[model samples]
Target chain A: GPKVLQIPSHQIIDMGQMVTLNCDPVSNHLYFYWYKQILGQQMEFLVNFYNGKVMEKSKLFKDQFSVERPDGSYFTLKIQPTALEDSAVYFCASTGGSSYEQYFGPGTRLTVL
Target chain B: QQQVRQSPQSLTVWEGETAILNCSYEDSTFDYFPWYHQFPGESPALLIAIRPVSNKKEDGRFTIFFNKREKKFSLHIADSQPGDSATYFCAARTEGADRLTFGKGTQLIIQP
Candidate 1:
């Protein structure tokens, strides 16, 4: 099975600090996505990116959040000036465009203090 | 509002018994339904899935029963084992859409 890898299993930062979560999606995958899961809650879609642009985003994707996969490198989600409510486990997923199934990576737990 | 909904916040089933988890969606455009299971401290993994074109899909002991007209689907784990205990999430995506809408997960406990 193809695997997606996420950097930093866990992260802790001050409320106003910036954090970047990196994802190494399956090499042949073209569509990428980011999801947020708070403890004891369901996972929520944050945004989806394809061809260097955002295709769709949920209301949970705040203005402070951004995503990019520059130069075919790692896809990243950057949060500037994080807030307390941003504390959650972030999971990265990707699809090869041939099927609707999206493979997920081990999540990166983000904690904002 | 949640586009997808799952019932039974938590369930306890005895080993060797059958465990059924239910799900429903509000969006009629959603054509793909996938059920993913997550062990504690682990990411969700696709277990079984079904499209509206089919009323049923099965793989090993896991089966997905889809009711397109009713806008509902369910995952059935037959001959359950202790290892089957995990949080199951039901998700849906419309054709040509890459983002998935997930239902609130149902935590299943298979008692031995």
Candidate 2:
């Protein structure tokens, strides 16, 4: 089974601060994605990245959010000037092809105060 | 606007019973449906999936019943056990789409 690992299982940050969540996806995965889940809510898609570019994004993905997997290293989601509403669990996922099941990481819980 | 909708936010069933969870979607282009299960302190995993070309998909005790005309689907867990208690999420993927639309999870509790 393919596994996606996320660093910093939990993080507490102040509002407006910059936070970067890291994800280590399956070695051979080509497509990467980010999703946000608020407490007791559905998981919402944030963005999808492929080939060093963003393929698509949802309304929840504000301008402050960005994703990158530089030099075939860890895929990272950077949120700058975070708001209070940014408190939620962030999940990272990866898939090998265009239409397939995605393997999710053990989400990183971000708390903004 | 919710693209995916799930009924019975929570359900409780006795052990050895059948647990039926329902889901519906508004997008007609969605052809791939995957049911995911997650437990406390665990990552969400794919339990089963079905494409529009099929009417049903079963894997062990987990089964998915899909209705393309109604734009709905459901997951049926038979012979439920206490270990089956967890949060189940129904997700939809449109053809050639990169993201999945997930419904609010259904929390299932199997009482022994």
Candidate 3:
């Protein structure tokens, strides 16, 4: 089975600080996605990336959020001026263009204090 | 409004029993339905999925029965075991869309 890896499984940050969550998607996969899941709540889609650019985003994707793959490297999500509501598990997913299945990482638990 | 809805926030089942999880959606355009299972401290993985073109899909003990007209679907786990205890999330995606709209999730506990 293929696996997607996330760096710093857990992160604790002070409010108003900048945090970058890194995801190493499956090597051969092209589509990348980011989702936010608050405790006891449904997982919400934030954004999806392809061809080195954002293809779609949800209302949950605030102006403070941005994503980039940077020359086929780790797909990164950067959030600035982190708010308390940003505290949640951030999951990264990837898919091969042809399949309906998307592989998800273990997720980075971001705690904004 | 929630686009995807799942019933029974939590469920408990005895070993060897059948566990039924229900899901419904508000979007008629949503044609792809996927069920994902997540264990504590892990990311969700796809358990099974179905398209509108098919009314049912089966994989081992896991089965999906979809009703496009009713805009509902369900996952039936036969011969449920302790290992089947986990949170199940039903999600729907529009055709050719890369994102999934997930239900609130249902936690299943299998008693021995």
Candidate 4:
């Protein structure tokens, strides 16, 4: 079975601070995605990355948000000048190709005060 | 547009009973549907899935019934157990796409 790993299971940060969420996707996966889920809400797609470039991004992905897969290492999502509304569970998912099945990581719970 | 919608925000059933979770989608282009289950403090895992071309797909106690014309689908859990208590999400993706649009979710409780 394939697995995706996310670091810093839970994080707490003050408003206006910077936070970086890390994800280690499945070894052979070619596509990476980021999703956000608020309390008692649906999981929303934030962005998808492939071949070192962003393929698509939702409107919720703001200017403060950025993603990168530097040197074929961990895929990172950085949010600078975080706002209170940024508090939520950020999930990382990966798939071998463009398919319906996407393996998800445990998720990084971010709390902004 | 909200692509996927699920009914009955929550459900409670006795062990060994059958639990049915309903889902509907508005995107006609959606050809793939998957149901994901999530326990508290854990990420969602795929339970079962079906393609629009098929009317039903079953794997053990989990079953997915898809109606292509109506754009509706449902998940049926047979012989439910307390361990099956969790949140289930209905997701859809169009062909040749990797992004999945998920429904709000249904919290199912299988009481012992």
Candidate 5:
């Protein structure tokens, strides 16, 4: 079965610090996505990446957020100067193609104090 | 706009009973509907999916009933077991769309 792997299952950071979340998608997948879910809220799309470029992004994806798939290795999301409101569960997903289903990772829980 | 909505925030049923989860969507362009199940501390897994062109799709005890005209769909779990307890999310996506819109979610508990 195809699986997506996320590093640092849980992270706690102080306000104004930087944090980077990493994801290793299925080897054959071509599309990668990031979603965020606040406690008791619906999951919201953050951004999508394909072919080393950002395909689409939602308003929730702020200027402090950046994603990269450098060297075909880890796909990472970095946030600079994290805010308290940034606390949530971040999920990474990948799909083989447009029509294929997206496979999700266990998620990284970020708690900002 | 909330593209997708699900009813019954939570449900509890006996192991041998049938659990019906309801979902509705507002986007007419949504062509793909999928149900995802997630256990505590785990990522969501794809349980079943259906296309708008089909009225129903079944795989084992999991079934998806879609209504293209009404923009509604539901997931039916037959012969439910304790292992089936989890939070289920209804999601909608369209062709060429890079992201999926998910409903709030429904927590189902199957008691043995």
Candidate 6:
């Protein structure tokens, strides 16, 4: 049972502010992903990163959003000048080579006011 | 557009009853289907998964029935218990795809 850890279980920030969500993916996992879930809605894929580069991104990944692992450290998702609609629980997931299973973190609940 | 869809937004099943959750996808190229269940305060954990190469996958009381021709699949929980109450999400991804398309999840309630 691999575990992914996310910092800041909950965050409340004013609109137009910048927020960074940190995720410590499973130790050996190489692929990282970020997903956004509005309350009672489906989880939407925002982006996926591998080898320090973005592999794919969805429309939901706005221009204000960015992601970086920073020299094999914690994978971080940053949103600058956040909008009210950006308020949602963000889950980080990771998996190793050739494995179809992606283990998800506890999720960081970002609330924009 | 939703690539993955699950039926019955909410369901309540009595103990010992079988609960069936349906899911379908719009993409025919999707080769992997996985079901994840989340408890009240926990992250979604992989419950069971299946590939198009098989029509059925069984793991203890949980089973996945896949229909590649119809682009549909379903999860069956037999002899349900109260602990089985959780939100179940059906997801799909194509081969070599890194992102997963998830359904709007089915909230399952096991009535004792």
For candidate 1, the per-residue lDDT at A82 reads 99
**Model 2 chain A — which ten-residue stretch has the worst lDDT?**
A97-106
Off by over 4 Å in 1: none
In order, the candidates keep a fraction of the true contacts of: 0.71, 0.77, 0.83, 0.69, 0.83, 0.80
Clashing pairs in 5: none
- TM-score of predicted model 5? 0.97
DockQ comparison, 1 vs 4, better candidate: 4
DockQ of 6: 0.86
Error of 2 at B92 (Å): 0.3
Error of 1 at A102 (Å): 0.3
Instruction: Summarize candidate 6's per-residue lDDT along A76-103 as a digit string, tens digits.
Output: 9999989999999999999996788999
- Cα lDDT tens digits, model 6, B1-112, are 8889898999999999999999999788898999999997788999999999999999999999999889899999999999999999999987777888999999999999
lDDT of each: 0.93, 0.94, 0.95, 0.93, 0.93, 0.95
Docking class of 3: high
Off by over 4 Å in 2: none
Query: What lDDT tens digits, residue by residue, belong to model 4 across residues B12-89?
Result: 999999999999988888878999999987878989889887999999999998888888999999999999999999
Q: What DockQ does each prediction reach against the true complex?
A: 0.76, 0.87, 0.86, 0.78, 0.86, 0.86
RMSD of each: 1.1, 1.0, 0.8, 1.2, 1.0, 0.8
How many angstroms is residue A56 displaced in model 2 relative to the true structure, after the best TM-score fit? 0.7
Best-performing candidate as measured by DockQ: 2
TM-score of each: 0.96, 0.98, 0.98, 0.96, 0.97, 0.98
What TM value does chain A in model 1 reach? 0.99
Cα error of candidate 6 at position A15, Å? 0.6
lDDT of 1 by residue, B14-92 (tens): 9999999999988988989999998977768999889899999999999999998899999999999999999999999
Winner by lDDT between candidate 6 and candidate 4: 6
* Model 4 CAPRI quality: medium
Per-residue error for A50 in candidate 4, Å, reads 0.7
Off by over 4 Å in 6: none
